[model samples]
Target: MKRKATAVWKGAGKTGKGTLSTQSGVLKDSNYGFSSRFEDGEGTNPEELVGAAHAGCFSMKLAFVLQENDFEAEEINTESQVILEDGAIKEVFLITKVKVAGLENDKFTEMVNDAKDNCPISKLLDAKINLEAELL
Candidate 1:
């Protein structure tokens, strides 16, 4: 499987602006720039996009893992915090609250850990992965 996104930037680094377009069209021509990325600006940024992807990816992976264990998640809410420090992504913190019936807390924690460790984005990121999971 393959996916692609395009970025177009013009002018100087600090003052320049850019637009990001994804093949899926979900993020077509989204605005991004130095202000939007490093400061509060009316646009999206790379870290925000990465956080969304990580959250979505982790959720889906957990669903599949639960299915494999003969269980199903009633709901899985995951929030990813991509910590950027020293101009690099130092860590990804995955905070999740799951609602699954008839699943032991220990088993659920195991599955959550597995999903956090094995999710595609998680595997791709060369940074520390921290998780806070609640089996509600």
Candidate 2:
């Protein structure tokens, strides 16, 4: 099976006010533990959450880049696919899109790379990162 992570961003970065979600369906007022072996679980595992964080962080980082460039992204969506190999996270595939006016593909790609390279999550991982980006 494959695990994936995704995040979406809209409008300005500062304009983003968000909510929180817990894997055990909101651990509020509840005891938490594991129910299954390493093979399975009732909730998500660390790998999935890591991918999800990478996606969210990438989107926000891209948003920051846009805002810094005096541009506002109408929306941005990013998906990160995490691959585990040899008992380690081997690679991450990032697919992302941005909708901003008058932005060249080259510069957009540059900014995307910048975010991919600089996001805290990305910095934490020691895997090869590949990206596909689109500007609309």
Candidate 3:
């Protein structure tokens, strides 16, 4: 149950360039560099990738939690914000919106909290993580 990705960098500092690839080829040879990470550029960045992973992980875990409790959701949308401060990742904020029928607010909040705390990505992150969930 292990996965891997590779990053290759050429040159140094702001002018440097790199490529990111994953074992599954989802991001094969994707371009990333200082501009992509620090400014508006036409490529993906590490923080965005981490945000995507966090959103996906939290949503999936929430789905499982709902199913286990005999509840179902029409849709679940999540957005993860990665905050970089002092040249380091400082916080991750997870914002979730769910469309569910006949689910109690307290129970839904409980499950969301459970997913936020128990998701594998959440567990792996070393920074502060916060969740803002809404029922729609």
* Prediction-by-prediction clash tally: 0, 0, 0
In candidate 1 the C-alpha lDDT for residue 128 amounts to: 96
TM-score of 1: 0.98
Candidates in descending TM-score order: 1, 3, 2
lDDT of 3 at 132: 99
Cα-based lDDT at residue 61, candidate 3: 96
Lowest-scoring 10 consecutive residues by lDDT in candidate 3? 34-43
Give the true-structure RMSD of model 1: 0.6
Error of 3 at 24 (Å): 1.0
Clashing pairs in 3: none
User: Model 2: residues >4 Å from true position, as ranges?
Assistant: 1-42
User: Per-residue lDDT tens digits of candidate 1, residues 1-136?
Assistant: 9999999999999999999999999998999999899999989999999999999999999999999999999999999999999999999899999999999998998999999889999999999999999999
- Lowest lDDT 10-residue stretch of candidate 2: 28-37
Please give the RMSD to the true structure for each candidate, in Å: 0.6, 12.5, 0.9
Ten residues in sequence with the least summed lDDT for candidate 1: 33-42
lDDT of 1 at 23: 96
| lDDT (CA) per prediction | 0.95, 0.74, 0.94
Local lDDT at 125 for model 3: 87
Model 3 misplaced regions, further than 4 Å: none
